[model samples]
Target chain A: MIYLTLFWTFAKVGLFTIGGGYAMIPLIQQQLIERHGWVTPEQFTDFVGIAESTPGPFAINIATFAGIHVAEQHGLSPLLGSVCSTGGVVLPSLVIILLIAGAFHYAMRHWAVRAALEGAKPVVVGLIGSAAFTLLGHTLLPAGEPFHWAAAGFAVALFALTHWVRIGAVSLILLGGALGLVLRCFGVSL
Target chain B: MGAGAEGQVSLGRRLWALTLTFGKFGGITFGGGYAIVALLEEELVRKKGWLTQDELFNIITIGESTPGPIAVNTATFVGYRLAGVLGGVVATAALVFPAWLVIVVVSGFYLAFRENTWVAAALAGIRVAAIVLIARAFLRMGQGVPRTAVNAAACALAFALVALLGCNALWVVVGGLLFGVLWHGVLPRLRGRRAEGGAR
Candidate 1:
């Protein structure tokens, strides 16, 4: 039952993950965090960080991690859970792509298909904006806790740096970890 | 079943080759889908001569516009084009395998050591960085959308509903698709019909 739930939940996430991997954030937050309470906001944030830092596609990494976490929480096998969730997420893509591959040219040229995608573009941006806003709030001010000045400062610095300098995602994440350890050396907990 | 330039290769050998190639891709690509795009262009298009540049671009367009992750879509498309249905399945599984294994190991460690003070502090910083990345993506993606009243409204409405009112995002996405069909598809045709009547 737990495996089935994980598969279904991630399948929905996969189905809605249009545009790219970042688009999955809002959906996962809704389904995993709000709907199932499988992981806390903090853990979800961690999952995003870990997913981004890890190799391979972001969608697969996050799904596998969430599946394992949920299964372990339920005293089930983490490996099977990961398989189910990961398979669930990939199944939609496999089926859809195969169906469309033969008729690839025509499918892309279809008017309704094009229009729907065109319309969904801005909404996807909005959804990504919402994810950023929610994560920013959670990071800067935890529930029932005082504002985290160190984190706020890091966020501002990192944001500015990204705008000014072209830093890749992996490097930025590594820099963040290094900075965190540096701060810890000074007895300052971020 | 036999098609494409590599038709001379045996079926079993070709499937194994797809597994190895996609497995290498899955293990190396960092960040997200776009990175994999560059890699595929370099390897399949330029190096292996498996796909032409035009085909790669078309695949990218289809990948982005379709539902689900772009990397997976690309993998499936390329896989099927090269081999068949079985090839598509094998390629996608190979692509996902390394990623799944890495995460499974990482998750175990993450859960075990997450409470350590050092790990907690590091995670705190990483969390902030992750938010920054997401915000950056929002800005970058927003710039791609054409500036229009309806679009602006859609963006703002989706944000408010999800971020403020705590509405379900899936429904919001569905609503966005419907709005697209209505505004871009049906509305234009209706306007054309009215204009034609006025001319008559």
Candidate 2:
């Protein structure tokens, strides 16, 4: 039953979300939070935090965490629950994408469809923009300064480094980690 | 599959195009999806002519819903658009390679090297930069958003549901879709009838 639910939600997200992963956030959250109740608002908040804090895909991380939680709660055995939930969410995307991989070349060229997409483009931008501000509201300008200066600096440097210096993604992460170690070595606690 | 690449540009040529497309997107694409989308427009549509504007638009819409990053979806869409099945496969694999490699390598050695003070400071700095990057993307996106009352309301509802209230994203989207369809379609038509009746 839960598997079916996961598939349904992801399918809608996968089928309708035309812009890609980041665009699915509000949609995914709505499915998981409101309809399914797989996670609570606070847990959703925490997951968003961890997703941002860690590396790799944010949506995947959420799927993993949510799957694990659902599985454990339902007494499906830890491994099985995690696998089912995660797999359920991801499977729809894999299947539909692979199947539609080729046939799309022809059927997707209509003008009305183009206008619909043009409308969606800006909506996606708003959704993505809201995601960033949503994070800032939590991390930067909370009820108070909750501001961790070092984290802010690290993000800025990385942005500048990647932007101006043209360092690669891997390089920026490594350099940032190295900088973190240096701060800790001197007991800077950053 | 599908007789590999032949005719028009030869399968080999298409394959090469697939690789180069992802390779360049991989190397460039600074901030995230939004920035990458612009570059994708330039290279794929304007320069390469690999896809029409309508196709590109549809691809972005489909890409948004899939489990991976927007960039990944774009790559897969283009690859598929250009070279049938294998094109999508290679494009996805290549698109994921750079970021996955970066993350995997970092995760592998991070714990061991994380104790250094300079390293911590730098990571802290990077986080700030990430926020800045996100900020820039947000500002850029703002330029495109429709300033209509309906659109504004949708953004607000989304922000509240996902951000402050922490409502589920599915519900928010469903609500938005409902609002979009009803507010734009049904409401105006009903209002039009009322206005016509008043004129009568």
Candidate 3:
């Protein structure tokens, strides 16, 4: 039942999300944290970090992580949970693409289809913005904890760094970890 | 259904080739969906000639517009084009395999070492970096959308609804689709009709 639940939940995520990996964040956050209680907000943030740094698509990495985490929590087989979750997420895309590969050209020609996609575009952007805002809030201020000055300052520095110089996601993440270790040496937790 | 340049290859060989190619893509792409797009262009279009430039563009367009991650959608498309339905499945699986494996191992370690001080510190920093990355994505994606009042309104409304009101994101997305149809599709048609009638 858990496997089925995991699969179905991810399938809905895959089918409903149109914009890409980042756009999937809010829905996943809601489903996993609020609705299912499968993952904590902190763990979800960690998953996002790992997913971003790791090779492969962000969607696949996060789904697999969530699956394994959920399965482990239930004392189920982690591999099986990952299989179910990953398979569920990929199934919709496979089916939809296969079904439409032939007719996609014709379908895309329709003004309604294009219009609908165009309309979804800005909304997708908003969704990503929402995700960033939510995650930022969670990172900077957790429940029953004092404001994290070190983390906030780090975030601001990184944000400013990105604007001033070109930095890749992986590099920025590595830099953060290194900087974190340095800060720890100085007895700063964040 | 059309047999393209790769039609001459045997099914088994083609499947193997797809596994290797997409597997590499799955292993190497670090950032997100768009990174894989560039990889596909270089490997499939330029080096391997599996897809033409025009076809690649079409795939990216379709990938973005369709549901799910753009990378997975593109893999499905490229695979299906090369070898048929079976090819599509193989390519998608291959592409997903590496990412899944890495996460499984990493998550195992992540949960186990989460209590460790050093790991926790690194994670704290990584978390902040992750937020910055998301914020950067937000800005980049925002730039792509045209500067129309309706688009600006939709973006703000979506943000407020999800971030402030705690509304379900799924419904907001659906609302966006409907809003698009009404604003872009229906309004234009009605305006065209009115203009034609006035001319008559």
Candidate with the greatest lDDT versus the true structure: 3
Of the candidates shown, which would achieve the greatest DockQ relative to the real structure? 3
lDDT of 2 by residue, A1-190 (tens): 7655554565566555543345656877788789878788877776555444444344444455565566656766544544454444444555567666555545447443334444454455555556566655554555655666655555555656656774433344356457666766776544
- Tell me the whole-model lDDT of each prediction, alpha carbons only: 0.79, 0.55, 0.81
Candidate 1 clashing pairs, residues 3+ apart or interchain:
none
Ranking by lDDT: 3, 1, 2
TM-scores, in order shown?
Answer: 0.64, 0.55, 0.66
Give the alpha carbon lDDT tens digit for every residue of B25-123 in model 3.
787665447556655644676467787655664565567667899889999999888888998999999999999988877786765554577877876
What DockQ does every candidate get?
Answer: 0.43, 0.19, 0.45
Worst 10 residues of 1 chain A by lDDT: A168-177
TM-score of chain B of each: 0.56, 0.60, 0.58
Tens digits of per-residue lDDT, candidate 3, A61-103, equal 9999999999999999999999999999899988999998967
Query: Candidate 1, A85: how far from true, in Å?
Result: 6.1
lDDT of 1 by residue, A1-190 (tens): 9999999998888887786787899999999989999999999999997787677889999999999989989999999999999989888878988998878657658777667666777776776678778767877788999998978888899989978997765566667778888899898787
Q: Is candidate 1 or candidate 3 better by lDDT?
A: 3
| RMSD for each of the candidates | 7.3, 8.5, 6.7
Off by over 4 Å in 1: A1-89, A100-104, B1-95, B103-111
Segments in model 3 whose C-alpha atoms lie over 4 Å from true places: A1-85, A100-102, B1-95, B103-111
